[model samples]
Target chain A: MHWQLEIVFFIVLITTAFIALDVKNLLVAVVTLSVFSFISALLYIVMGAVDVGFTEAVVGGGVSGILFIVLIFKTSRRSSD
Target chain B: MTRKDNNPIVSLLSRIVSPFIMLFALYVIFHGHYSPGGGFQGGTMLAAAVLLIRLAAGREISQLQFKKSWGTPVGSVGVFIYFFTGFLALLMGGNYLDYSFLPLGLEAPVTRGWGILSIEIGVGLAVMGILVAIYDDLLEGEPND
Candidate 1:
């Protein structure tokens, strides 16, 4: 059971990172990154670093993505810089 | 959206979803001590809530804005807060991030807990602010954005 959970989690984690990388739209990418963070947070729980996981979830999954989206709206999506 | 003004779908979804998001973030942050989360996770979640507000309300109406103009300063201050608080611990003759030597009521469990919590809060602030700033900076030079 534990092994199955780990397998599922690993798959989720990998997929999350790829979603962040694969998404073309900047906003989507940012959102994917947040999802990635959440997966990491869950991974942390599995690894017995509950505190670290929590931090990762909130900061990485929650705030960072919002910041990205806001910036996307304020700035252009073009990659000049 | 501008057209979503009378849209029950958008309003209803946001009403139900947003509060849950915010609450979950808080829960993750608050329960961090005993569980799989902490200031960073919690703080980001908190910031996410703000971001959600920004998204739904439109940039014109800021629910909890730090402002693009002040992005750099706000983020920097958040980082400085985290470091400065840690520096305080160092000033009391402990190693960097050495919570045991924090001057918070003198080294007992209560003091130690207090010290750690303070540091976490500072880190949370920094993480939220800096991430927001970076996002703004990245999107700043885009055209037709």
Candidate 2:
């Protein structure tokens, strides 16, 4: 069961990572990156690194996501690349 | 471009919610030794709580909660605290970060535990301050400039 859950999380993590890179809209990309962080945190928790998982969830998903969104607001929404 | 958000719902809800988040952050920091959370997670949560208010309310109003200028200084102080703790151990005839010699009037293990707790607090404060400072800096200047 744990292995199955880990596999599912890995799938979601990779998918979000690719979407975050591929998405043209910067805001959507930021949101996708947040999702990626969340999944990675879950993976860490499953692996029993609770402290690392907690930090990843709060810092990576929460603070970094907010910072990225604010960055998007301050700059252009559309990516040149 | 620090504009006050006019949405009453967001302002009201965040105002109500931020304090609880901060309380939880403190809990996480204090209970880190026995739990999954620690300085970094708690500090980020603390910063998150403050930023929630900043984003929901306007920059001006949020300043009442946490001044914009306080971030970097608070972070500096936290780093100082960590360094001072380590230096104190060195002065007391131990290696750097050797908390057993802290002269806290406790058993060696307990002294080390206290030392770890103090270090976690310092790290938490530093993380909170730096993260908030980053947010403040990112929001500076005119949007679309």
Candidate 3:
């Protein structure tokens, strides 16, 4: 694996994680969280764990995103704090 | 989402794509032993496909595709399948989940392969059903604003 690509992914992963946390809009946060998950899955594949990457991509990015969106719809979309 | 908010394009496209996602999920499940994907990943993919339709087509329409009431029963059946496989092996003079002792009338290696496949199928079904069930329950429990 190329170190350059790994570095790029790591940067994006960290960026998304922070954005997901810092965002005030719950929907945006959830979308960013999904991005974070997909980036991490890419990192896992780059690190040679294909199976782990696949699971992360499917569960973290897809299922969890839907669940979070449903949650946002159920409650308030804007954060109180 | 409400019917008033439905977009025809999104509905059509999701309906078209969901089937292919399901097809790929099945492929991943069956080829799991030879590939990077297995039961859980495949099952999640399957649920994603179903959820896609649910999201695009609204709740009432999607019910015809997969009823919310079916989710728990499907999950229960999947668990039963997994348990029965293991128990059958135990009853046939082998350790629990020992495939060679299964009454498949095949060679040990082949029987083991079949056993693993069956296990994978069980796991896939269980994961798919439970995930969808969770989604359904969450939506059903949502408070009206």
Candidate 4:
């Protein structure tokens, strides 16, 4: 059961990373990065690194997400093609 | 890009929720020794709560909660606090950050615990201040007027 969960999380994490990189819209990419952070946090928790997991969840998902959105507001949203 | 609006529901909800988040962050900071949380985690949480308000209500209004100018100074104070603790230990003829020589006349372990707590508090303050300062600086270059 544990290994299955880990495998699923790993797969999702990789998927999110690729999506974050591949997405042309900066806003969507930022959101996908937030998803990646969340998955990484979950993986940390499952591995028993609770403190690390908490930091990843809060800093990665919460704070960075806000910062990125704020940046998008300040700059252009669409990537230069 | 969508023009940012001060939505009523967002402002109202954020006002109510931010205080709770701050309270929880404090809990995490102090309870770190017995729990998984510590200064960095709690401090980031504090920043998150404050940023939520800034994002929802606009910077001018959020200034009432925490002024824009206070971020860097507050962070410096935190670092000073951490350093001061070590300096205190040094004044007592111990090595820097040597908890056993803290001025309090307590058992060695207890003194260490107190020292650790103080350090954690300092770290929390520093982290909180720095994060907020970074956010403020990031937005500063843009002409808001």
Candidate 5:
């Protein structure tokens, strides 16, 4: 395990998580969340859990992104809080 | 969502890419036993392919690809396939989901492999159908304007 690579991934993961939570626009938040998911999937792969990484990449990054976008369109674009 | 505007480029690009995604999804499902990827991941990919079209084109146009009404039934059939496999093993005097007595006329190991394959297929289908169904249901009540 390359600790350096892992550290870099962790940094990005934390950054994206913060961005996702802090963003006011729900669409940007959703997209950032997708990026966060993809990065975590990468971290999973780095840790040698290939199957879990594959699942995270597919469901978290792809399908959930679309679902969240649909939810935004159906409900509201901006978060009230 | 209804067609808000026409963008041939988006529609055409998605049309071009969706089939390849589906093909890869099938590959993932079939090779699940030997690979890191499996039924759920592959099934989600399939749903993604279908949803790509639905998002690019409008709902009415995309219905030609996958009817909204067919989702729940397809999911049910997939579940039946899964349960029937297990129950067939049970009825054959083996424990539930025991593949040795599956009557495939193959060696024990080979029959076990076949059993797992069928289970994966069922899971893949069920996941794909249910996901698409969720997407459809989520958008069903939206007003067309």
Candidate 6:
């Protein structure tokens, strides 16, 4: 119910998304993506779904990070596009 | 002798900090039920520690250092652990996730707490694995560090 926390979370979420988008380096973008995930998880906590939010942070931010890194290793690091 | 004996903080603290990080991670995992923190949070924290090692020790630290394969497995494994606990409860003939259903002990709240704890551990492993996986993948993708 605390409005300030909600505002802060929103700002963080937006910033994360922007960072993920703006960063040229794929790795930097990926790290930004994690930041986004963490912010959303915080939102979930505010919404009273602490457990669900926790899961999201873990999976979206954590495991997904690992997957991205692996895929990067398998593929080319340079953005040919 | 020179390289190994670099800055005082980074040198002496290096050995101490990593273990402490690891221990704190475990502590967070076990204390999830009674605390505000839980599996995912703890897991990410754990991964951060590894990332720190990677940053400080450079890539050559460990050959078996959770490169990639660990990611997907950890994710699914966490879910598996969660469901498995529920299944065990179901087999015992109590409603899904019903603590009394488990044969371990009939203590109401404790049984439930235990279930959540197991799930948290799984979640911690999964989340931590994923964070590193993502970082490695993303960084690896970049042209250069």
Question: Top model by DockQ, which number?
Answer: 3
List the lowest-lDDT window of 10 residues for candidate 3 chain B.
B136-145
TM-score of 2: 0.91
Judge the docking of candidate 5 as incorrect, acceptable, medium or high.
Answer: high
Q: In candidate 6, what are the lDDT values of residues B1-145, reduced to their tens digit? A: 1033335566356556867777877888999988767887788778867765654544544334555556667778877887888889889888787765678765877777788888889888887777677666555544422
Model 1 regions lying over 4 Å from their true place: A6-81, B1-8, B63-66, B138-145
In the range B1-145, model 1's lDDT, one tens digit per residue, is 2233544575456556777877876676566565666677766765665556545554445424447566556557767777877788799898887777777676467676776676667666666666555655565554432
- The candidate 4 chain B region of ten consecutive residues with least summed lDDT is B1-10
Off by over 4 Å in 4: A77-81, B1-4
| C-alpha TM-score for every candidate | 0.64, 0.91, 0.94, 0.93, 0.96, 0.58
Summed backbone clashes in each candidate are 16, 0, 0, 0, 0, 13
Q: Summarize candidate 1's per-residue lDDT along A23-57 as a digit string, tens digits.
A: 77777778777877887788778877766775676
Writing each residue's lDDT as its tens digit, candidate 5 over B1-145 gives 5558969999899999999999999999999999988889998999999999999998888899999998998888889989999999999899999988898999999999999889888989999999999999999887661
Q: Model 3: per-residue lDDT, tens digit, B1-145?
A: 6335779899999999999999999999999988999888998999999999988898888898999898888778878888999999999999999989989999999999888888888888899999999998888854321
TM-score of chain B of each: 0.74, 0.93, 0.94, 0.93, 0.96, 0.77
Candidate 4 docking: what grade?
medium
Error of 5 at B29 (Å): 0.4
Task: List candidate 2 segments past 4 Å from native.
Answer: A77-81, B1-5, B143-145
* Interface RMSD per candidate (angstroms): 4.0, 1.6, 1.0, 1.4, 1.0, 6.8
Highest-scoring model, TM-score? 5
lDDT of 4 by residue, B23-101 (tens): 9999999988889998889999999998988888877788999999999988999899899999999999999999999
Q: Predicted candidate 1: what Cα RMSD to the true structure?
A: 5.3
lDDT (CA) per prediction: 0.66, 0.89, 0.89, 0.90, 0.92, 0.73
The collision pairs in model 4 are none
For candidate 2, give the docking quality class from DockQ. Answer: medium
**B22 Cα displacement, candidate 6 (Å):** 1.6
